[model samples]
Target: MAPMGIRLSPLGVAVFCLLGVGVFYHLYAGVISSRIATFRQKKTVDLRELLALSIEASVQGGREVKRIREDDSLQEKTKGKTKEGASEKLTLGDLNSHRKMFYLFKNTYPFLQVNSEEHDSSDGEATIWTPNIPVDVLNKVPASQMVPSESVTVWIDPLDATQEYTENLPKYVTTMVCVAVDGEPVIGVIHKPFTGHTAWGFVGQGANVAPRESYNANNPKVIVSRSHSGKVKAFVQQAFGNSTEIIPAGGAGYKVLALLDPSDDEKPDVYIHVTYIKKWDICAGNAILKALGGHMTTLKGEEIDYSGSEGNPGGLLASVGMDHKKLVSRLPPWDQNK
Candidate 1:
């Protein structure tokens, strides 16, 4: 006998080999997916961590502003200068001592990137910025690198309404974070450190309207920047004139939220504004607003595109209610006096 020749079924051998390959491929895919998921989780954690750090930096800015307001020595340097001319005297270089804290906290993060609207960002980016507004961390963030599932652009006016901050307005200054996706806000967080109060809105995610003390529904309120004035007040007066009460608050982020929520007992139906600002000013906050089932657009009801050049500035008209069309019709465009 020839050592009893052994026979194996070709089909069975082939099936076993295929099964082995399938198992290996499945494991390889699982590992890859797992790694991707882990990366996303870590990124999210990092963003939140960054948010906390930003809050710290914002607080520092607030303190600096307060000192400017309280310091007779510093105020004397800027005494002759009007609030409009305050920036001439105020320089980031002068705040080097104060800004060091921001630098220190900023360096701790490995993936930190400048928000395009940073004062030092390219001229095109900064051109859109309104005077006296501090670009928050999100303003410098590159659009290409945001979280994948939900694209976001954040506006961090670390010291929003800076003029007020420098003018001795207690708690008039604030730190803001507006989260927007493709031009709509999905979530937003605004903190008034002076009051130790926080307000958050997550579209469809249920808003907490934090700062328990800040939550009220009796008298609706609207916040506005301390320095810039005109169309916002006119629109409010014409829209709500006798029907609703208008409470003017300072800070764009704060104002936007005021319409979403009011510290008074009643909430306003709409928040409207017409001004020249860049994508960095409202992108993040708009994301949060959109998430809350609201909409923001130009007075013409056209969507504001972030891709435009700085010269083509876009203004906003946001509404928690869909009453923007009526309001738009009633008010004149920024260029035209209605």
Candidate 2:
């Protein structure tokens, strides 16, 4: 064996090593490409699954909101008030519900990016949320392509209508979840704890509920914030005529629901808010609107981008059955309203 051995020059050795490296790279790349092709099929959730998960999470959060309120354990307090006498309150319900949902999504996907309204979710709550995805909700979700985990941002408003919640108005309280994909709201789940009614919507997929048929879009019944009507009342009244019927309401979730309500007398034609509002306050509503062939945008009629800042500045107008552009065109500049 020693007598049969042969030696190679330095250049030959270098070429041989280079060839070996090229072969190894080709093999590794083939395996990786094969895995990449089957990744979603073998080991990932579809958009529908995430949508159902969101609905379940919202329902659980809503349950906590109602249970905490009924037990008289909410223990509400004024967190702070803006210079405009607009007070923001916080309750134990808010903290617990958010903690419940934050863990709910985190534990399930472990990769979702969640933007919550509550900033005090440092402590862990006794994880009471079950991973039960509602069968009805899952069945209703339309099948869709899977997105990369990092492209989705889940926005949570654990307790909407805090003031109304403190004031014993259960109808106005809601827990909301919005899943925005690549800066666009694609799934929305808004649950009213007091009513046990859940509304879920996906951008391309229609909602479970439908808008009423009897609505007169020309007359346009508008729903606005009860506490922060501010100059919005005058602005809406002027744009839609004096008889347009401006209904004061609480919570972005409630206002959006009012638009989708089937009741003839109660359902409003539009939801308009003329003030700087947080993204979590309206993201779910906006998705719900989009799902129903409706749309929500700045008072200036610009579509909102949810990937970046948390606050939406130029006010908002959400409408179904009416021309959003035409409606917004009628309104004056947002700055001039005040």
Candidate 3:
């Protein structure tokens, strides 16, 4: 397992995340063009440039997502329902957003592997375009602390909370990107499209977030998904006592952000997922949480590995200002089939 207490640096996040995509039909359309291979002087490139591409892609793609919703062109399709009967869905938001991030990287590196939830990855066109390197980020996280390009995996979730979005709950929607090095997420950016708010962090560097204030370990307030609340609710009530407060919300990104919400009534001390979840759904939040000196792991307290594939079957438990293992040990082993 990776070490605990990894930090998130705001400067590090700005350098890497601020990720982008589609506003110009083609990959390099919107911004002034710059070649991304600044360090390919015989085969070595800086991690900062790749992160810049992600940031620009995420920013532009976020605008497209908000525009799609504003135009009422969701093109929604039923993906069945969650176990508790909430709708499972897909929309143009998911497809287009995935493509935006993919094109930004594939067009430049051509061979770089990016993990996503959508299936329309055909590599239709390749264009060489990327944002200029973020110098401010380099000044924060020097080269010595970063991993090589070959060891990185970028996980992008174009639109999270599709179900909430369809239900006219735009407040919960977000676009996210995570860069994991050697199976540990080193950087992440979570962009809320409707509000144009983006929060990002690079592990061990520090975060733009503040310490939590609403946690009462003896009677913690926890957040879980509206659709997947039964098991998680039971676990929290059991582990933290029946008096523990449980807040049901949508979107993994939203839940993770809530852990740092400044409002007393809105902030949740913990976020938990009771079943198998896709890597794209939780990877960015994990990276951000880790960067904040927090923990996000399975019920057994093992860290989630973000090296490819979509599913994590061990379940999840995340907290920002508390002992993650102490919380984990309080719960009895949960049945996966329950």
Per-residue lDDT for 57-108 in model 3, tens only? 7776688788889999999997676554656799988777777776776677
* lDDT value for model 2: 0.82
Residues 1-338, model 2: lDDT tens digits: 55776789999999999999999988798888777765633243467777777787788888889899999997888889753567789999998888888778776765568899887737565454354556665566534558877778889999999999988899899999999988899888899999899998888766777766755667788889998675677888788787778888899999998987876366788888888888999999999889888889998888899889998887899987777788888887678235
Top of the candidates by lDDT:
2
Task: Give the per-residue lDDT digits (tens) of candidate 1, residues 34-151.
Answer: 7776575434323333444444554555555455545533432231443234342343322432343334333443233324323432222111111131233334322223353334
Q: RMSD to native for every prediction?
A: 13.8, 7.8, 17.3
Ranking by TM-score: 2, 3, 1
| Model 3 TM-score (2 dp) | 0.81
Best by TM-score: 2
State the C-alpha lDDT per candidate.
0.49, 0.82, 0.77
Q: What is the lDDT of residue 190 in candidate 3?
A: 87
Each candidate structure's count of clashing pairs: 34, 0, 19
